[model samples]
Target: MDMNEIREIFFQECEEQLAELETGLLKLNDGDRDPETVNAVFRAVHSIKGGAGAFALDDLVAFAHVFETTLDCVRSGKLEPSQDVLKVMLKSADVLADLTNAARDGGTVDESRSRALVKELEALANGEQPAAHAAPEPVAAKPAVAAAPAPTDSSGFQPIPFSFDDFGGEEEEVLMVAPTYSVTFKPRAELFSKGNEAALLLRDLSRIGEMSIHCHTGDVPTLDRMDPEGSYLSWTISIKTEKGEEGIRSVFEFAEWDCELDIKLAEEAEADDERPMIPVPFDLSLLEDEPVIGDEPHVEMHVEPVVAAAVAAAETATGVMQAAAAASARAEKKEAPAASAAAQANAANAANAAGQTIRVDLDRVDRLINLVGELVINQAMLSQSVIENDNNGTSSINMGLEELQQLTREIQDSVMAIRAQPVKPVFQRMARTVREIADITGKSVRLITEGENTEVDKTVIDKLAEPLTHMIRNAVDHGLEMPEKRIAAGKNPEGTVRLTAKHRSGRIVIELTDDGAGINREKVRQKAIDNDLITADANLSDEEIDNLIFHAGFSTADKVSDLSGRGVGMDVVKRSIQALGGRISIQSKPGQGSTFSMSLPLTLAVLDGMVVTVAGQTLVVPLTAIVETLQPEAAAIHSFGATQRLISIRNSFCPLVDVGRILNFRAQQANPVEGVALLVESEGGGQRALMVDAIQGQRQVVIKSLEANYMHVPGIAAATILGDGRVALILDVDAVVGASRGQSLRQEMSLAS
Candidate 1:
């Protein structure tokens, strides 16, 4: 092990701790305050602080110390989380990320921000700042130590006394217990610098216990490859101690992060001492032909049947005497059934065993998806070849090829499933955002999540966080109304923000709805004009005006506030959704609330699209947006205004646009209504009939980002590879429809002349 290895462990533990802190934050603000959440927050901060102390990161330790103090107050119910407290905690999280990054980089972090946050936290803690520059009395400090006995050099196993088989595998276990209890502990990456040693701690504990040691050498590097500074070995030890649980826990009071330690009482020490003929060593280099404790011979006398019967009779007599001596014996035995039932119920409360979480290296999942994407391409080619060969009467190869195609398709689906993750974590994050916004806006908001287990690609899930957080906050601060306003409107005192996720038509749709005051159309329009997002006299539909908020710095907040007057968050949300090759739309009524729906492709690597030609240029349109394709008569194209082309489709007059003109591509003709009309529907309840040269059928295409290769082109969501190996830009139907509407309005005004 080397510095790089240590760095990796530090980064990994930092991520896990951050996730725990985030989950705790969500639970903290889940409307109902749970003491467990505060304890969780405290534990998370404590772990980080301990880890930082071991790494000799004074800045990190100091910052986390303050954070832990504040959380301790919450844990003890001395201070409930107010908006101010949450803000400080959020800043503390930011500091932790910075400190972890700094430690990994072998540098120090700026202490100014952390000090400011600590000052605010302390203010709330004591209702004032510590008496100006007064030196406080030092409290009694416990000896910092590793949770477990130190592993001998070049050993790999950490010692634990408990038989953990009864507790199940090494997954979720309660780590925070009262003090003085012993736990076999392993400190995370940087714990050694904190002046803690497993050996020293074990030695101190031997005052109360008889101890034996063994080291696991599996993780030890070769002598020539070993780094003196790195901890490569873990240990397993057997200890008999009289100290209560808290006393044992105190040994590892300052070292827990990144380390894996397990502890259990030594109940069979006598049996262990009597059984083994060979003695396990206390140090390494005696690894060859090491003592095998379980294989050693133990004396077992075979008893005659009569002798066994007599011993059994004596044991029965002793049992009867004990039962008769204890009056509570029968009562206890009577409660045996209930006790067993109670134990069974306790088992159920341990935790849900059903995949609470699964960890996968993201790079591996991405590689699998990339391979699946290539398979999809090859499958398309095979299908095409099979169709051509079948038409040519090659029956034998066609049947085999068809089977191969099906298997390949199934394999692709299976690979995609590996990258799918439930979006519950994302929804939970949104619940916290709602709390934040409610506090900021002086409103009451309750979050209700539906279909939280809806699965999507990891890539989509990653990109969705920012956008969803912003949207949820927007719904609370801007979409929801004040408590008085809600009460006046005969609504519940607490407004509801519903965050839902579902799969529809081969895509994931996330909807954030708020039962607050709906979008004030006049205010949005007026703000749009003031911000130069729209002309003062411009007449816009509610949908169009509502979208202006997504424009940078287009907030309708009357004044700058803590929440969102800064105006960067919503714009970021819109851009992030767009970057994921998704469309976001808003729907609102005057009195009712608003719904922000984001429809995202399941995977960014591949998609099903319909190929259409516009002015001889092939373009791919997502099949999800296409309702139907029609070959309309030329006479069916009617002019509502100078620029608005209307086509009668399914007995309704729908606006028609030349796809080439919308994309700013070369237009061969204006009225190509007889060619092909794609009846595309936008997310914002608008319909557009796009005119193209021809329909080239539907096929799955590999999606390549325009942003990766070139700048993002407006009206183009992404570019994909056609079957013929040509590049086709996918039409952003929503943006194109909006553009067409704008053009139609301008043309109609000109036509009045």
Candidate 2:
């Protein structure tokens, strides 16, 4: 709508382009030699450079210009995209992102970082290996790329050479003479609309050699009839460069599809120049001023004499003739509206069939979700009211209530789905994090991500980065042994860390596993004792000992380091996960490795749950955790210890956990035979029978965070409002199951087996 709005849109597009750039570079790093990938990477930087030039973002344009050059070499196969090459490119992408942010938000990036990257990129383009760490020096300000004039020596001396081609070339003179080419680029409106700039294109051509560009305006229409979207401008460029027509055409490679581009040897196009044309030659001398040398002509006219017969007709105009003409004109105007309406209808239908989308602000979607949550509550309340007042008779009111329930649930789900987004961007950031950690620790590590496209709530995704990043740093710094240690342990020198996400039940499970020397139980136990977190003689299972690292102020590192030993990482990770209504667990092997698994809800807004009464207190068990509900018979219940019990189903025994006692709703365990047994699964591949007093039917309820609204309860995940407007606790199935096990979970599990 306006310049500022358009600039903001350009910056928004820069973010997408930056993401694509990183993705394509990562593909190349992963040994993908697909030509399209290289092309895509090149186009991203090129697009940024073009857009930056449009807004006069000099630093961005300069850096992207240099970055794009190296990528061009890679795209054209002039330079091989080896591991080292990609490493440089990845860092360059980071710098480019910083530059973009700086352009948008008004800040400065590290001059040293940008300057060093510029030098390395330049060296790579020149077919030289980049230094591991190039020192930064005082570099020129980001230049506004345009048709730069010929270079001069440091002494400011310019060289002048004369070509004697007209008199026939001598052998010595011909060797020094460069071939010339003529290029005509007439851009359609698509070019400008798509963020490509004509000035930037001409500037790219100028890089090849000395060039003169002409602005052709003969096709421009008069102001009254002119279309703002029309394409009436064209450019004819004449250049003499050492690299011939091939080099010249490469400048327009990115724009070939959106513009009419033709390139040929200068002599081949000499005949076309003879046609009479209005050309405005661009002056390259004034780099600080506009390149165009003339104002645009808005209108043109041609004069002719009026005929005598026309004047005679006007003097004798009749009423019948005027009436007939008016009627005819009115009829023509009346028909136009019907045809126009039909065309508009057809366009609308085509768009609907295509299923196009518009971007809505996130705050609006959030408001919609809140409204939908209110709608769900109201629907439930209405249903509850009808059940209490109506008799056991069939009625249309009952049927209508059923229909309304289904529709409301669907609307809530649809609204929540709007906030769902892929976790790939976070995973990509983790890759960068891995790279940074690897550099810091000097460890040869490979990060493998799976199911990065798994979609989750945007809120969950936003908070996931911190915890994921901490885990990644721990995996690299403490989980993975150094290269020499890995080799000594009969493992690959480069340790592998695999991060994966998948939907399990109704939750998204993210597991981070590493291949290296696993957790050392002896060291961990010793550290726990030293930190006074556990008694020296305390007996703990391997799982318990391994989990000690998650305790506050506990670190197994021999000495303090930048990555760890601060005793805050894993604990912070645990707390952050807990804050999101998620649970995390750890499993480790002596020599193999360790795996940390996190289970989180798909959306924090609402969840399906089974409403049950525990010790006269209403509680909800998440539907996702329940495998099946069964009534435990006296024959199936058996006591393992004085207070421990197990329920046998289909020849398998699962621990029996009383929801009432576990949640402190009652002082004693509930009767298993008289009540319903919910067979629920936990994240660690364990099943338990949760005993509840009575079943109150299943319902979808909006999740209000207990910790946020009130305080955290050990076995209760969150709080929700019931149809009767009573507050009920949502059971944290994993926490309850885990608490039932206590220290004897492993021993009881072994006994059951």
After best superposition, candidate 1 residue 541: deviation in angstroms? 2.5
| Per-model lDDT | 0.61, 0.71
* Residue lDDT tens for model 1, 270-300: 3333221111222221111111011111100
- Report the lDDT tens digits of candidate 2 across residue range 455-501: 99998999999999999999999889999988898889988999999
For each candidate, give its TM-score against the true structure. Answer: 0.57, 0.75
Q: How does residue 433 of candidate 1 score in lDDT?
A: 66
Summing lDDT over every window of 10 consecutive residues in candidate 2, give the lowest-scoring window: 296-305
Clashes of each: 26, 0
Q: Which regions of candidate 1 deviate over 4 angstroms?
A: 1-3, 28-375, 378-400, 422-452, 465-499, 514-518, 527-537, 550-573, 590-593, 612-617, 626-682, 686-695, 707-715, 735-753
Clashes of 2: 0
In terms of lDDT, the best-performing candidate is 2
CA lDDT for candidate 1: 0.61
